[model samples]
Each structure stands twice: as structure tokens, then as C-alpha cells.
Target: MQKLSPVPYGSLIFAPMEGITDEAFRKTILKLYPEWDYLATDFLRVPSAGKYPLKHLVTHFGKELSDVGWVKDKTMFQILTSHRSFTVEMVKDVAQLGYPWMDINLGCPSNTVTKNGGGSSLLLDLNTLRSLIKNIRENFPGRLTAKIRTGFHDTSGFKDSIRLLNDEGIEMITVHGRTRDMMYKVPAEWNYIEEAVKISQVPIVGNGDIWCSADVDRMLKETGCHAVMVARGALKFPWMAQTYKRGFREETSHERLQKIKEFFQEYRTQLESESISLRGLLKQSKSVSRYMLDGVENGEAIRRKLLLSQTPPDFFDILKSL
Candidate 1:
């Protein structure tokens, strides 16, 4: 099996968004625009209390991303968990598979993740967070990175969190600048990002509200972050990395729509190749179409048509109309 290498941190990176940053999306996005810096996998839910087997939890780790061909090296597996031993075990297992990097997902704000004491909820328990980091650092000798929000509720411990990361030798950290309460509300606190940059010893990747190339530039200039991670921004504009690489070139409606069509085809190929149920595929198709509709004038209308699609033929017909 061949290994993929990580993309250099030039400027832009794809944020690890659950249910959105799947292998198909990364592979397709890279095919269209190869300038993206790095991509973190959707957080892997670690097996807890030895209830589930390790093989079950790492279902998508080696095979799914590796089969995607080119994303092997550029992608890092992100693990979400509230237990120290489980995190250490998960990292060790992947490390044995020749996986070069492991990223801890400390910033996921989803209710499902938080209610279980996994995501940003860990932020409220800094002691456990620190122990988890330290254990992973000791167990996994290779590169280790962590993603985080400013704080659990308010960013009161933001500085302490940075200090913990540095002390534990986290090579890279991405800060989303929003607390659990914020939940991506209006206006990302870039000022908070700027403050994190000033305090951190390692490179800080700034995330949140970066809608276009200009926002990428603004993030770098204002926050002095080493890189920018785009989540909702990439969904809203799939061509963002390409535009940033091309100096933010303007794309006409026709051209952009064509790209969205290509995305539909790319994602369909991915779904069909996998072992998924029809209902699951349809749901995925509808969700992706919603994302692809972003700023298009006829987006809602097109999305409605896609939801009405009952079969593969119906979905393809809608793409043809696009």
C-alpha cells in the first residue's frame, strides 16, 4: 500500500467537518484544486469502556481514505473521545499502521458529541484534556495536532489551553474562535484568534467565517495565524481553495454551476462504489446538493427538485438540468 504525504502549510486548509468532510469530498475537492494545505478527517468516535472493538471504530481509517488514491498523506485521522486510555490506545493502533499523524478533535460542538463529554465539553474539564494530550503525546511518537474552540463557554481558559498544548508538544493547533454557546452565530471572533496567535508557541490555524479568498487574506493579516481552515465556507463555495490559489479569480454563474454539476457526479461515483443503502445514498445526495446550491439564484428550486428525486435517474436528470 502506498502512503500519501501531507500538503505543506502554504496558506489555506480544509477544516474537519463531520458528515461533510468524507473521503469523496476531499478526493473530489483535491482533484479540482490541489492547493489545499491539509485536511483533517471527520472525527473518529473512539471505542469507550472496551464496549466496541478497535476494528469497528477505525472502520474508515486506512481503507476509506487510502482507497481514495491521492489523499493518503494529505489527510490526518481525527479522534474524538473523553477517555484517556482509549485515546492513547486509538493513537497507538493507528501509529502502528504507519499513519504519520494523529489529530485530537477537541472543538466539535455537536450535541451528540458534547453530551457524551467528547467535543468542546472537554474544554470545560481542562485537567482531563491535559491528561489526554499528555498521554497521546507519550504514546504516539509521530506528529500530534489538536483542534479547539476559544473556550467551552467563554474563552476564560483560552491562554491556559494554549499553554497546555505547547507544553505537551502539540505540533499544530486549529482554533475556531467560538465557544459552545456561540454555535457559529454571526461574526467569528478573529480578535480572539489574533490573541491566540500572540500567546501560542506552535503555529495556530485560524478557523471560522472565512467565506472567500479575501477573508483568507484578512484572517492571515489580522490574526497572524499560520494557516486558515474553512468549514462552512468550503461548502458555501467549493471553489474557494482554487480561487485563493488563483488570486481570487471571479467565476461566472455558468462556470460555477458547471463545477457544482461536476461535484454531483464525483460524489455519486463515490457513493455508488461504497457499500451503502439506497436510502442512505439519497440522504447524502440531498445533503450534498444543498451544500452545492450555496449562492446560486435557483438554488432552492434546484434543491427542491433534488429532494423530489426518487431514483438515480431522477438525480442524474437534475444534475443534467444544472
Candidate 2:
């Protein structure tokens, strides 16, 4: 069977996050820390109502597909859609664009997505999920993978979900350790991830609540997952993949602050090149700063001040003072 370009054991994946992991952010992170084994695109939602043109797909993936061979190699094209007909067509387009693998998003908990029978909503309907995967697998020539929450309302279907994906010839699975309803309010149940590893025929990647290197170690040891996918945690520490690859030493508070400064500078440059307006730039900056600053001293106060800033210069001035 075909497989995703192989990833090493204990690999670190930078999770796809909507609105936050756009081309600018991805390029900045890859520029700063090149150790990430895999990176995923934010889910490209295939419209249920019409044909998804190849041009739109090209625009969504941006430079990840158009330039930088290594970025293309490390990245996974992700799609979120329950419309099997649209998905089959979209997967064919994606394969023609040369993506080596594609991932189905079955873990998004947003009400907007679930209301439309996409994302984690599929978890509640296994028959639909199975059909969607089967259809895509039949159409796409490359490897196929999926990311799923434990279940819709509870984890009673967790093991069965793994079994189903395996049966459908899914090359890999990433299990986020919470039901759709649990969201991020509670601790991730790593035990379920361990169980997935046991029952799964392919690699199982553990995801959720991995905020630091220590959590990565714990998740790998506890769950025996083939890898760990960092979501919000990657925003918090963009250097995390590099840190883990470099043997997990704790960086000094000053070192971390300096890194944050550099990251924002690089991030700003990328966003500016994309022609984002000043207001747009500030909004994006704050979204990233909110997570990146959590470990810094007086971070909350700094975040509040940064939030009040009306312009990019103002935001950077406040960060510089820190």
C-alpha cells in the first residue's frame, strides 16, 4: 500500500490551525526553526454547493506548493468537507498538484463546521465517515490520513473509530484526546491515544494539550504514539520542534523573550509582503503574541498593553520594553 513519505519515530508535527497557520506564519516558523518533521495546512473547506476550482486550491496552498521544495516535502495538504462528491474531485485536483499526502479534518469542534456536517460532526456518523474516506482513498493516488477527536459526545466509539480508519486503508491517524464536546476546557485523555496505538494498524499521532517539551516526552512515553502533533502549543513556542530535536534543554527567560522579538519581526515582514493593512497586521500580531507570551514574566499585562496598541510600531515598542 502507498504511504505518506515516511516520518521518523517520535516526529514533531506543527498542527494546522485555522486563520493562524497561513502562509506568512508557516514561512516564519520554518525560517526560524527548521526541525519540524511535518507541517499541515489549515483545512481547505470544499464548498458543498459548487465545484472547487484548481485555481482556488492553488491559492489556498500558496507558496507551500508553488515554491520551496523542502516546505512542500514537509507539509501535508489538509481538507475538511463531508460532501463526498466534492471531496473526490478535490482530492484528484490535489494529487495532480503533486501533494504526496492528504489529511482529513475530523477534529474541528467549531459550531459553524459541525452545523454543516463537517469536521468533528462526522464522528457522530460513522457510516458517512467511512464512505467519505473510502471515496477519497479510491480517487487520490497518494497517501491518505485523518485527524479525529475521540468521539462526538463521548469516547465510546474511540477504538472502533481507529479500527474503521485502519480498515479503510488510512495510512496514519492523529488522535486528539478529547470528545468534540470537551473542547479544550479539560485535560486531554492520553489513555485513549495509547489505546489507539494498540489497535491501529498504522501510525497513531498523539495530539492535544502538549504545551511544552516535557509534555511531548510524557505523551510519547505514555501513549506510545508514533509522533505528537502540536497545535496551540506550537504557537506558544515556535521553536519547540527545534528545542525537542536539540535534546530538550530549557531556554532561559531572556532567551525566550529575544526569540519572541525575532519571531514577531519575521512574522511582520511576511505579513507585510502579503499586503495586509496596518489594522490587519496588528490583529494577526496580537493573535500570535497572546500565546507566545504566556511563559514570559508579566506576560498578561504585556498582552493587555499590546492589545490596546493602535499600530504595529506601538505593539513592537511595548514588546521591546519587555
Candidate 3:
């Protein structure tokens, strides 16, 4: 087992969620809770064919995403793929874009992804995983990492799977306890994550079912992982990363309300900075605000207002009214 220095590696991480970690969302989180170890971009789909060029792919990074500056330094640019050639070809462009780190995703459980022999499906083939990481290292020339589930169906390949990553010089690895079959239905098997921490030659970031600071401590205590990754937790409680830095203190109702107001204000500010259509900006803000406003007293009512908001001013009006 290995431990990384307590910089970004030893710090708490925001997981790369598909629709949740876009540019506006990342910016909002950074503004509110800048203590996060790093913010990861949602996985960029590396198509085996067709026009998956930088222009198309960059859109998912959203507007303000960059290789440097803001939101913690370890901003990971993650990709999902099964085809080596296509992934290799895309890696060149990714590196050229100046992204500091690139992650091979073997953790997403979507059928659309797995059925295409990407995502967790790659777990069933260690040789291919090794080859892809090796190819990426030889070609990309940047910090390389991979996020993986326990395995496709079980933990059978778990040890060798992480070994391939470490052996290939992957800088860090995040292990989500559920296999592809688990698909997040079951609790993330942290004991399995403990196993990875036991034998992994590189730093392991544990993921799954971590919803609070207590859970963070539990993951770290039980697994001795180098760090923890929070996904759904960050969505519902945007201040979660703050807990890691300052220790967990329950948010009072007044504090929650204040946080909500501040969060949306940042959201509006970020959207305006992007210079997108008001309609598009409202749609984007509403899309993410629902999570931030979750569990609040008037959450549903606010969501309804956002739904009715047709322009940026309307959106800001609703937020103000809240």
C-alpha cells in the first residue's frame, strides 16, 4: 500500500458525475466550497468512431473548464472507451488541450456505456485495460488515472485490475465498491475497497455511499484509503467538502437558507459570464439548482418557479423570491 503527500492527493475529491459536474456547476461549487481537493469533469465519451473531435468533446467540459486555475489543481479530465485506437487518438488531443490529468473510466454502469464494451465492461478484460493504460501513458504524457468498480460482476479481478493500473504507472486510482452488476443498487462494498487499500501499490481514493463527514471518516478509518470521493453527497449537501477541512458541523436552518441564496447567486453569475442564450442559461441553472435546493423548506416550490422561469431575469427573480 502507498500513500500520497497531503496536498490534493490526500484531500477530499468531488466525483465526476454525468450531468452534475458541468462548468457552471463546478464553478458554483468552487465559489461556495473552494476547499475541495479537486473537481473532476464528467466523463467525456471517446467514441470508437465518428466526429468525437476536440470541438464536440470540449462542449461537455462546458464553458469555463481549463487545464489550469481555480477549483483546486487536480481537475481530472476523464474518458470512457473500449477501443484502443480511438482512445489513443483522443488522448493526443486531450494532452494538447493542456489538461493536467486524464482518467480512464471503468466505473460507469450505464447500459449505453457497458453494452458498447466500454465503462465497467472493460473490467472483464485486464489485458485490454493494461494495454490501454500503457498506450495512454506512452502517448498522452500527462498524469494518468482510472476510476473502476469492484469488477464487472465480482471482485475476482480486483487485485490484478488495480495492479495493472499501478504497474502501468497510473498516478492515482479511485475504487467504487459496487461492480457493474451492482449499478449503485447495493451499498458500496467498502470492505472490498479496504482490500484495494491493503494491496494497491498506488494511492487509492474510495468512492460510494459516502454521504457525510462521518461517512468520510469511516471510509478513511476502515480502508486507509489515500482520499475519499463524494458524488451524490456533494449534490445534496454542497458544503460537504467544507466539512473535510473544518470538521463536520451540522448546518442550521438559517445557515442552509443563506447557503442556498449564495449558491444560486454564484450560479447566476457564472451563467452570465458564459454569454449563452438566456433560455439556455436558465435551463442550465435550473438543471443544477434543484440539487442544491434539495431538502430545503421550499425546495419543490422553488423548483416549480424555476420551471416557469423563461429567461435569466425570471430565473434570478425566482431565486430572489426564495
TM-score of each: 0.91, 0.96, 0.88
Q: 1 or 3: which has the higher TM-score?
A: 1
TM-score of 2: 0.96
- Residues 246-309, candidate 1: write the lDDT tens digits: 7877577788788888777887777777766878778777776666676677878887888899
Task: State each model's CA lDDT, in order.
Answer: 0.78, 0.87, 0.79
Q: Write out the backbone clash pairs for model 3.
A: none
What digit string (tens of lDDT, one per residue) describes model 3 on residues 1-322? 0222333445788899887787877878777888887778999887767547676656666545664344224678888888533877788887776665778898888888888888999899888777877888887776788899999988899999988888998888899999899887988899888998888887899999887778888898899998899988887777887866787786865677777778878877787787768777877777667666667777778778878877878878776765
lDDT of 3 at 119: 91
Name the better of 1 and 2 by TM-score: 2
Instruction: Give candidate 3 misplaced runs (Cα > 4 Å).
Output: 1-9, 50-72, 298-316
Residue 20 Cα positional deviation in candidate 1, in Å, after optimal superposition: 2.0
lDDT (tens digit, per residue) of candidate 2 on 227-253: 999999898899998888778887887
| Model 1 TM | 0.91
The prediction achieving the highest lDDT against the true structure is 2
Best by TM-score: 2
